[model samples]
Target: MSAKFEVYLDHSGQHRFRLKAANGEIIAVGEGYTTKSACLQGIESVKANAAGASVVETDD
Candidate 1:
């Protein structure tokens, strides 16, 4: 099966988001939102940091 990722903001308008797969499996969860711009920048940082990284999938 293939998985899709998503992003969201917390109730407090904080970027305390969670990155999960289409199957609802959590990949990563974090909180770092002092500002909206900073939150977006943090997302970019996560993607950049993941570039060329290996993705390990385990069978359920």
Candidate 2:
């Protein structure tokens, strides 16, 4: 088993996605999108941009 992305509708009927680990724990979530296609695009953008993403610490 490996990590995977799942797309589903929210309580407000908006399209959203979540990335789940093999253990079935959600590691990440995407914001709601008006259309399913846009939600999927958001996933692709994460795939394309996150591989080399930097980690930064910020103070709030």
Candidate 3:
């Protein structure tokens, strides 16, 4: 049981994706895209760039 990405259409019929943890909790969500391919590409981008991504606190 590992984290996985699930792609699907949103209520507005736009493509979106959610990253779910092993326990099935959604950990992250991607923005809506007009095409599924684009949505998948977004997932790939996250996979490619997230490993070394820096975490910084923002004052909000």
Candidate 4:
């Protein structure tokens, strides 16, 4: 009923932020950030712009 947030580090150690559905399928892969905080900010920004989505991190 609500969106979820997930975060991970890429092969380059950068942050990878993604939004997905509850079914474990990706909805959107946001631009990579140089820092975790930056990625988190991106997630927040995405969530503010969307709804009923989940965020996740993926390997590079």
Candidate 5:
């Protein structure tokens, strides 16, 4: 059970996406996009950048 991205339509007819963990948890939620292509691109961008993505520590 590997992590996967899921694209779907929301209540407002906008396209959205989410990354689900192997355990079926919603690890990340994407912003709404006007087109499915953009939604897919968003997923692709995540795939491309997530490998070396960095975290910026901030004061809480």
Candidate 6:
């Protein structure tokens, strides 16, 4: 299994998504949206923006 995004509904019936690893742990979570289509668009936005994203090293 590969890392994947899952969409689900909250208690308020708003849609949200989580990016989970194959081990079934959530690594990232998405914002709540009023509609499923918009939720999907959020996923697409992540896909589009993530490809070119750069990592920043945080000083400890």
Order of candidates by TM-score, top first? 3, 2, 5, 6, 4, 1
RMSD of each: 6.1, 0.5, 0.5, 8.4, 1.0, 2.0
Query: All models: lDDT?
Result: 0.70, 0.98, 0.99, 0.79, 0.97, 0.97
Q: Which candidate, 1 or 4, would have the higher lDDT against the true structure?
A: 4
lDDT (Cα, 0-100) at 17 in candidate 4: 77
Q: On a 0 to 100 scale, what is the lDDT of residue 58 in model 5?
A: 92
Name model 3 segments beyond 4 Å from true: none
User: Between prediction 1 and prediction 3, which has the larger TM-score?
Assistant: 3
Off by over 4 Å in 5: none
Q: Candidate 3: give the clashing pairs.
A: none
* TM-score for each model: 0.56, 0.97, 0.97, 0.69, 0.92, 0.86
Give the top-scoring candidate (TM-score).
Answer: 3
Comparison by TM-score, 1 against 5, better one: 5
- Choose 3 or 5, whichever is better by TM-score: 3
After superposition, which runs of candidate 2 have C-alpha atoms over 4 Å from their true positions? none
Per-residue lDDT for 1-60 in model 1, tens only?
A: 455334566777776556777777988876758676776677678778888789899998
Inter-residue clash pairs, candidate 4:
6-55, 20-54
What does candidate 2's lDDT look like per residue over 14-58, in tens digits?
999999999999999999999999999999999999999999999
Instruction: Give the better candidate number (3 or 6) by TM-score.
Output: 3
Worst 10 residues of 5 by lDDT: 47-56
The segments of candidate 6 whose C-alpha lies over 4 angstroms from its true place after superposition are 57-60
Order the candidates by lDDT, highest first.
3, 2, 6, 5, 4, 1
Error of 4 at 27 (Å): 0.9
Worst ten in a row by lDDT for model 2: 51-60
Model 4, range 1-60, lDDT digits (tens) per residue?
444567888888889877668877887787779988999989888767767657889997
